[model samples]
Target: SQKIEQNSEALNIQEGKTATLTCNYTNYSPAYLQWYRQDPGRGPVFLLLIRENEKEKRKERLKVTFDTTLKQSLFHITASQPADSATYLCALDPPSGAGSYQLTFGKGTKLSVIP
Candidate 1:
């Protein structure tokens, strides 16, 4: 069966460096991918999405790369800070009819930005 996975462990980083998180999957192909950030006791907030045909996508201080050939995605936060500490999740969209798409998320990677 298709599965999405992330590091089950937490990541520790310094306050001024780039933080890299990884997402990996297997057994099936996805139509697109998405990343979200979730804080304790709060729902996830959407961050970035990329289609299978796209190689890479970016926002102000975040970047995402999707390699369908490898069935993996890499999420990056440049110039990360203590305020940026949170759990990041990666999701894969399985093919579905329009307006009926659903997303399944990986376990999520917890990132801690130390002072």
Candidate 2:
């Protein structure tokens, strides 16, 4: 059995700070990992993807690090703002040959920015 968990708390912070979140799993090894962002009542939008063999990945205002040995992933949002407030989701691709490549996502961590 595979399971992914993200922080359920709403992260409240001021603008211009970095927001960090964690994702953890147990009892499964995934072929890859993905991160997504979601606004209320909306579908998640892909932000980053990292393969099992890779260590870290980054985009303009975001960065992600994966550690297979630790079965975890870290997501960071730099220079956070009110517009950056949203739920961040961490998803995993099931181990190869499991029939489908669809992602299984954590419930997500809610981020809130106060101006």
Candidate 3:
């Protein structure tokens, strides 16, 4: 069975600092890694996606990395702000040929940026 895990504890950071979140998986190899942000009572919104072959990807103040060897992905937010406070989730699709579009998601890591 495939499993995904994220930090169960909340993460607090000062505004203007960088926040790093980790996602780890076991028992499966995915073709893509995705990051999403979810606010209270809202659905997850797609932030970034990185292919297995890609080492890293960046967009605006966000960055993501995929490491197949480690079966892990890291998501980073630069110059954090209070507005960035939310729960961040990592998801991965089943490996190719699995005939499923479903994605396994981590429990998410809550981030709080204090001013």
Candidate 4:
């Protein structure tokens, strides 16, 4: 069976520091990877997407890296602040030979930035 994983515990950080999140997947080949930020009681918002062949991507303070060989992705946020806090999620579609696919999300990592 395919599996996706993220930190179950919350991360607490002071203002102006970097917050890192990890996503690991196994037993499948995904064509693309996506990262999203979700606040409590709301849906996730797309942040970045990286193809299987891409190594890294960045937009403003957010960056995402994909490694097909390792079947893992790393998400980073620099210059963190209180407003930057949220549960971040990574998603991917595992190939189903039937030509049908759906996006699967990992349990998000909660980030807390102290003032």
Each candidate structure's TM-score, on Cα atoms with residue i matched to residue i, is: 0.92, 0.94, 0.96, 0.93
Q: Where is model 1 more than 4 Å wrong at Cα?
A: 96-100
Q: Over the stretch 8-93, how does candidate 1's per-residue lDDT look in tens digits?
A: 66999998899999999997778889999999999999999998899999998999999988889999999999989999999887
Q: What ranking emerges by TM-score with the best candidate at the front?
A: 3, 2, 4, 1
Name the lDDT value of residue 65 in candidate 2.
90
Model 2: lDDT of residue 108: 91
lDDT of each: 0.89, 0.89, 0.93, 0.89
Per-residue lDDT of 48-101 in model 3, one digit per residue for the tens? 999998999999999999988998899999999999999999999987898988
Each model's backbone clash number: 0, 0, 0, 0
Q: Highest TM-score among the candidates is held by which one?
A: 3
lDDT of 4 at 74: 95
Weakest lDDT window of 10 consecutive positions for candidate 4: 93-102
* Candidate 4 lDDT tens digits, 11-106: 888999988899999988788999999998998999999998889999999999998888889998999989998999999886857476778889
Runs of candidate 3 with Cα error greater than 4 angstroms are none
Model 2 spans with C-alpha error above 4 angstroms: none
Error of 3 at 81 (Å): 0.4
Q: What TM value does model 2 have?
A: 0.94
Worst 10 contiguous positions by lDDT, candidate 3: 1-10
